[model samples]
Target: MKSGFPSTSPFRLPPWAIRLARRQQNSMAGAADRMRFVIQLALTNVTAQTGGPFGAAVFETKTGRLIAIGVNVVEPTNCSLAHAEVVALANAHANLKQFDLSAPGMPKLTLVTSCEPCAMCYGAILWSGVRNVVCAARGSDAAAIGFDEAPKPKNWVATLEDRGISVTRDLCRDEAIAAFQRYQQTDGRIYNARKGLT
Candidate 1:
């Protein structure tokens, strides 16, 4: 909504938008449970169109809905990987102030974006003392994510896994698009990314 313009936060979507997001990722069963919990008390809501070059949508998971705090859509034309990384941190910091993370009943912040958060962003999240992060976008089809200016194979899930966050890749990557379409039903596709949700 909001003309799909770049803003600190997107317009509070109507019930239909929520339904649409759910339907779009319906095949994702785990997401259903996760979404149910995150949607309950969304003090804030945002969506990031950061799926291109160096952009990301940050989400803070709450009781029943994920709060879209800030988006890191830094373009390569304007900056480098290093600059993008700093921007991510600043976005997260500003988000904390908006939600008053220090207050009681503060909703858990979940960064839902198009790409894996760079190392600096990860550090900022850790420093912010928020743990619930959900990255909604997929990585580049050809390149792996890295902290360095130049990406390398060494920077994969291992980097985050070693930090203790349970890593789960969506079925979108390995599973073919047709395979993804096969599990569709009225409510949507039966999404089962590594099982655990009904």
Candidate 2:
């Protein structure tokens, strides 16, 4: 474990990113608009050289008010679990002060991600208590840029729906894919599990 005690900003998102999110807090309503916001975040993360080109946010399901935002912090935090979706959810929990978003009196939250989540994030959504999931790019888009998604279920979408969490995919897909491509063109680092380990 490589660590010397984490600071207050646990996820370590860029300062500008934190500001941008604050300025736009609860600023989006439509799904396409929200997707655009997160896509921009992903692009900014790449250009900022902070982490990977992935972004995610939590929103109130009914009103579409952005609750919290997160960009990838895997390499910076040296923790693979710091994926965008996980960070977003964790931030939401912290801000809302509720481990289960669906806890009584809590707003029904939605997870909006710039791209389809990997196996780990997919599992996170199931336990996050979010009522809905909004996705921009497909998981294959992440894979094209040399990211590993692990062995996520093929029926993942249906699976979430079965659990009462609605899943919406491809909300501004081309734009999200563009963000991934931008990362690739800029030679952004692609970190995944060390192959041939097990």
Candidate 3:
């Protein structure tokens, strides 16, 4: 019998495969349950050293099962693309072993973010194969909290819907806003790239 490639080889299994193999599957009740779970997880990032007051998660739409979670990592590290939604999507892809998230035969998935995705994260969602999105606040809300949000085109939600992605805004608007407020109150750094300009 021929032996497989050695484990010490440079070409090792992907991180997602290892994570999936080691972790237990997470199952939830439904949309409401999953939303609550994601909110709680996202809130924990409110005090993170790098990214504060932003959180996101991925869920299986049909099963209502939690897949992966992520928090913003923009400041303190200067990673412009480390939005909560982007991190969550990356985690989902890693855990599910599906880099091309929308590939055929994949389970239906949803991206739940504490705030509406900015322009970059919006693009990530469109290409991430998640057919549904649940958001706590809109881009304006994040801007209101002192974070610089990129401009979005008119009828953006409609555009996503037209592309077969359903978006549900304001899952818990007040609650989500409260997180940003808390961060602001605690003197959290607001890394606005467009500071000092109109």
Candidate 4:
């Protein structure tokens, strides 16, 4: 297989998402600034019918330079692994041409997501090598709309910090929740919603 090419079919952010990312690149500088952009991405994904109502990005923690952006593409790509945080981290690694984002000479990286990560993405954050995570909205907010975040240890945040990753939650809280509301209004699919976890 070609280097950096998935052995299977490749999926990507929609054209509109790409265009918007280009337009907004370098326009944000802090956790709050970044959260606004991510929430917009989630809401826009709903409006554009591109993906689920979740958005994430990787940025240089210092420069705040946008590294990569992701909106959930699970349904469209038919890939369960295409959660917003996973896509953003994968794209960030691709842009840096490396799997370990914390490699020497690399600037510190922060992953900003419109909502707190689900169980799968919590693991992804550990492996992604980003130094920090900033989230808007909580798992409960997603569950309110019938999406399951699955099981995460109550100590998940503390665990990340124990591993050298800092966690910041609830940035631009109301606005992020608004993205989920928009998704609900648009009848967005809660693909992970299960009838029973039992």
lDDT to native, each model: 0.34, 0.84, 0.70, 0.84
What is the per-residue lDDT of model 3 for residues 1-198, given as tens digits with 9 covering 90 to 100? 001111232222223323432342557656666666555544555544445687777777787666666667666346777777787787677667667767888778888888888888888988988999999877888888788778777788999999999999998877888888878887888877777575
Error of 1 at 68 (Å): 3.1
Models 1 onward score TM values of 0.41, 0.92, 0.82, 0.92
> Against the correct fold, how does model 1 do in TM-score?
0.41
Backbone clash total for model 1 is 22
Number of the top-ranking candidate, with TM-score as the measure? 2
Q: State in Å the error of residue 107, model 2.
A: 1.4
Candidate 2 lDDT, 2-38, residue by residue in tens: 0111123447777877778767744567888888888
How far out, in Å, is residue 198 in model 1?
50
Give the candidates in order of TM-score, highest first.
Answer: 2, 4, 3, 1
Rate residue 55 of model 2 by lDDT.
93
Instruction: State residue 112's C-alpha deviation in candidate 3, in Å.
Output: 0.8
Q: Which candidate would rank higher by lDDT, 1 or 4?
A: 4
Report the Cα lDDT for residue 198, model 2: 48
Model 1 alpha-carbon drift over 4 Å, by segment: 1-55, 58-60, 69-72, 76-89, 98-105, 136-164, 171-198
The worst-scoring run of ten residues by lDDT in candidate 3 lies at: 1-10
| Cα RMSD, model 4 | 3.6
Tell how far residue 89 is off in model 3, in angstroms. 0.7
| Candidate 4 lDDT, 1-198, residue by residue in tens | 011122221357788877777786454676788888888888899999999989998888887888888889999889988989998888887777778999888889999999999999999999989999999999999989988899999999999999999999999878988888988988887786366555
